[model samples]
Target chain A: MCTYETSHVAVEGAGKGADGWFPVTEATVYFDHPVAAMAEHTLNLDFLNRARGASARVAVELDATSAYALAQAILERLEAAPPALTGELHRR
Target chain B: MRAMDEAMRAETVKFAGHGGDEIEGYLGQPLGGGPYGAVVVIHHMPGYDRESKEHVRRLAAAGFLALCPNLHVREAPGASPDDAAAAARAAGGVPDDRLVGDVAGAIAHLTALPSASGKVGTIGYCSGGRQSFLAACSLPLDAAVDCYGAFVVEAPPPERGLRMTPLLERAGDLSCPLLGLFGADDQFPAPAETARLGAELTRLGKAHELHTYEGAGHAFFSVDRPAYRVEAAVDGWRRVLAFFGEHLG
Candidate 1:
């Protein structure tokens, strides 16, 4: 399982799906803010749902900061995963 | 100037497709030809606009009958920049399956051309690149080459599903040899994903090749884009010609 930890969140448990595709259940996200604060932000749940369904899933936990940082962190983690595959495949 | 002139002989031809609307494409052929193999060129996300037509012209100059179709007839043209942006916002997005159908239609159009050598192949860039890969996997084609395309290990969405990926899934039904080219710096589908795609192809025992240009980014072959790299694009064109010559011939 691939794991990445950021100041805003800790993401872990990455894996591929049965059909050899990247599954949506690969990440556990932790936020530094509380859930109440996150509720104040207008989250694009549709985008989140689509992302969750097709992309790596993150188990998000809110702390003290805003959801923006948590969302950015998740995006970074997802972006980071693809390069690992490239390195392995073209390892000259 | 000579090359540009040579590429300008392409003519727009309208043909009947599988029912809904009349299909039109830019058809290019060599000035002097003898039953050359046919090629269907798919455009990137910007759709089959000017650059795609130029691509068809270039392929024609290289002795292949190239066809490029406009895949966005269902949408209205954006009036101003903001209007266009708003139109894009309202349209949601073009579905991948419809893009695939456009490609299929282009292929069919090529096959029916009398001057074509029946042998047909495809090449695409960006989104078109993904479609080219899918065509190789799911359709009957002589060969395909993909540039900066996305490949998933898990099954993609039904519209985006080719079921052919990098490491995990095997490209069992791929009828022709495939070639994938990527830039090391492409953000969306990074170099590592391309590597996995190569690994999966290898595992399936399929004839394929993957080439990565070290410092290039996505859409490196697009002359109109800022990402264009002349050296990499030149090399890519050479490789594409060689690959098509080997397979489509």
Candidate 2:
């Protein structure tokens, strides 16, 4: 059964896709069936540049546990970084 | 009856779909010449991929002409199946009206085939399962099979951003006999949900048969996915073919 729930976000970054690297302007997060993952459902993330094309998408499927770990890792790495490095604020 | 690989003809075809829109579709027919009943195969949300095409061929091998219209063609023409599906999803999924129209077109196509019996059934998996039931309500179908479709009896949580509504209210409009295949362990249309639907259909006196296989969750019929449960899928297929035989044949 598909939940059909999706969370969208605007992201400024670059993603490497089948046609090479492209600017990613949108990211969609959902927990649903994976196209390539073995699990029945996973946390799926798609980085896309709609302007480029649908094929310009970099997708990832992560299990719940793995997704949680990745979230924590990103938060920790961002927090541990110097403010100047993250552009959170100017270093004195 | 085992059909050799070459005993079936399958290929991509273009058909006038919803609003007379030219859409790509996959058609698979058994080489056996006869007045065969036809089936409309609705692809799941994962997209119109090879597995869906296999389902079309499987039905043809079973002696029914089968067609699967690419539901994502309007969203992403010429894109990979997965990409097309993804684009459709991000755009809020296929509209119910459009789904019905495409299926109606498929029905028309099948009925026009020289060997067609003018009797057609529908079978769908996952999201398609729900659409199968929806189509039956909207069209005069001979038989319909729904395999683990969710949100047919309940609406998605309001925040899910999906463009669908529950069809239980339309149960009375069902014009065909229905066969339901569900996984006991599936949470979306949990065991309780299946029972509720069965009760409703029974109260309405609609011709429907529902089955729930234990030790199986959603997508148990998907051979390429981890959700595949061999025992459940095998028995489910047997029951499906038998159901279509009784009704569509």
Which candidate number maximizes TM-score? 2
RMSD over all Cα atoms, model 1: 15.0
What does candidate 1's lDDT look like per residue over B1-249, in tens digits?
A: 013345335887875433445766778876554476778887665455677888888788777878876554444332222222112222443455565677677777777766678888888887667768776776788889888765434343456323333423426877788888888887545777777778877888888988999888877886765577898899999998888888776
- Residue-level lDDT of model 2, residues A1-92, one tens digit each, is 49668898989989999988899999989988898988888899999888876788898999988998998998888788888788843432
Docking class of 2: medium
The parts of candidate 2 lying over 4 Å away from their true place are A88-92, B1-6
Error of 2 at B41 (Å): 0.3
Task: List each candidate's DockQ score.
Answer: 0.02, 0.68
Q: Which is the leading candidate under lDDT?
A: 2
Error of 1 at B98 (Å): 2.4
Report lDDT (Cα) of residue B40, candidate 2: 95
True contacts kept of each: 0.00, 0.71
lDDT by residue (B1-249, candidate 2, tens digit) is 224453888999888899999998899887866678899999998999999999998888888889999999998889999988888877888999999999999999988988788899999999999999999999999999999999889887786657789999999999999999999899988888889899999999999999999999999999999999999999999998898878767
How far does residue A17 in candidate 1 sit from its true spot (Å)?
46
DockQ of 2: 0.68
**Model 2 residue B4 distance off true place after TM-score fit, in angstroms:** 9.8
The alpha-carbon lDDT assigned to residue B5 of candidate 2 equals: 52
Which CAPRI tier for candidate 1?
incorrect
